[model samples]
Target: MSEKSENLVEIRHLKEYFNVNVGFFRSKPLKAVDDVSFSIKKGETLGLVGESGCGKTTVGRTILNLYKPTSGEIIYDGKPIKTKNDIREFRKKATMVFQDPYSSLNPRMTVSDIIAEPLDIHKMSPSKEARRERILELMGYVGLNSEHASRYAHEFSGGQRQRIGIARALAIDPEFIVCDEPVSALDVSIQAQVINMFDELQEKLGLTYLFIAHDLLVVRHISDRIAVMYLGKMVELADAKEIYDHPQHPYSKSLLSAVPVPDPKTARSNKRIVLSGDIPSPLNAPSGCPFRTRCAHATKKCAESMPELKEISSGHFAACHIL
Candidate 1:
């Protein structure tokens, strides 16, 4: 496909701010997603990685219109989403596999019903027979048996519940999926199973993904490209291998340095670049650059203004005064 045609989703200067209650008669804009932009190519997995509360999940939710964006544009398949009709149509084309599977599923509903909820909402299956058949087919895709379909979510393991969630996400036959830390809640072994299942499903269905997670190893394993976020802003984004080999931003360096290396020799040689302080509250963020508080390379320019995320190398983008 041509480069322009290759892009399935594009985000432009997306910002999602929430009004927080600080004290009596006090409020502030908590910049959850602050001027972030990127794109996901057709049938490719774009991993978004950051520490907790860095707005990774918020970005995904905002794009799907689960939480309306405070500002900026969300374009799907080259068309900008604006109207309620656009969102309704977008819902059928895109879906999410939430981070917490246990709470995401309803205790009142059976596995079959949970899987078929999207189908019913979209009026996908005309007849009851077709719905039942479709639900069974989806269950099979996620390695669940037909017998398990009638069971409640509480009866299954964490892995099984997540599978049910994934099956539901696929019910709409979506072209794009926002996977919000989909494997983080499972066991190490189960995480592998779920991650592999995602890979298999993407290949089989030609799906595009915005895979959000804090797990660097998982992101590295699945992503074609990776974007690093810090204090609600995108610090760096590049090809997965490129970022791993040579990250441009100081924050990216620190994050990658902490990823546990399996090799005894490599693990022993790797130096962890630990940051100096806890991430500052979004409600009281630094004036210039949010990462400057902990960055070793912070300079006067960094404190003066936030650097723009721009291309330093071919398809490699970073925001830092020192770089």
Candidate 2:
């Protein structure tokens, strides 16, 4: 469990589709996450990245069963998470840090009550005294003091509120956490602090993370490996440094090229890659390859069939007909 040798979570051909009404008495499936697959190893951080509406968030939600999968399998720690009891048990081992701190927390409840919600639901504490002690401990883990316990969520700043949310997620002693844009709503200065705290907590608690975010710099900093999504499908996955340095997929390359280089000389030398077309609606996605419509390297073969995500180099994968 200490070493990142075995996978802690595995998603197999996962699909999540919502029915959207198109016309009178007519509906079509909006494939939010379509046939996606990847894994996160024990004690590893796997960054999931893509533009908005690319289904990265949907994939994270689907993994935790917050939104049930339309099809495909979710395996956690080598076991299928299918039965109600299985899901219940899985919740104890896994939790989520939602995107927005303001919306996720209850303004009505005190910080202590909010942090203790998971402990209360699962009956983790034996007595009222034990619960009080545990609440303080959890708050301390996230850098909140005991005096802040009586304060409601709205009284605190966004960063502190997010810290409370993190404290809540850690309440159940979870082994895995799906951080759905956890720092996206925070101030740029505060974001580094929270991200660093996440790293520290992961080291202390032996936690694995499926960190869903669009900020390439953030993802690059926190992830050991990264997965890129286009439309509703996964286009590339590789070691974080490798993907940033040498993205193979057309969509992946376009994404990496758009990341701003901090060095003035490097920034001047960098050629910006701009895609031609807007992202197609999921309801009316292009045939075959999901990225084909915007990909400059797309050929007739790309439109005829979707490319399988296959290993190109050791531990690096990409889906492209041209490759």
TM-score of 1: 0.98
Q: What is the lDDT of residue 67 in candidate 1?
A: 91
Judged by whole-model lDDT over C-alpha atoms, candidate 1 comes out at: 0.95
Alpha-carbon runs more than 4 Å astray in model 2 = 1-5
Query: What does candidate 2's lDDT look like per residue over 246-294, in tens digits?
Result: 9999898989999988898999898988999799999999999988888
Off by over 4 Å in 1: none
- For all candidates, the clash counts are 0, 0
lDDT of 1 by residue, 248-305 (tens): 8999999999999999899998899988889998888998999989988788888899
Q: After superposition, how far is residue 295 of candidate 1 from its true place, in Å?
A: 0.8
TM-score of 2: 0.98
Strongest candidate by TM-score: 1
- Report the number of the highest-lDDT candidate: 1
Error of 2 at 96 (Å): 0.3
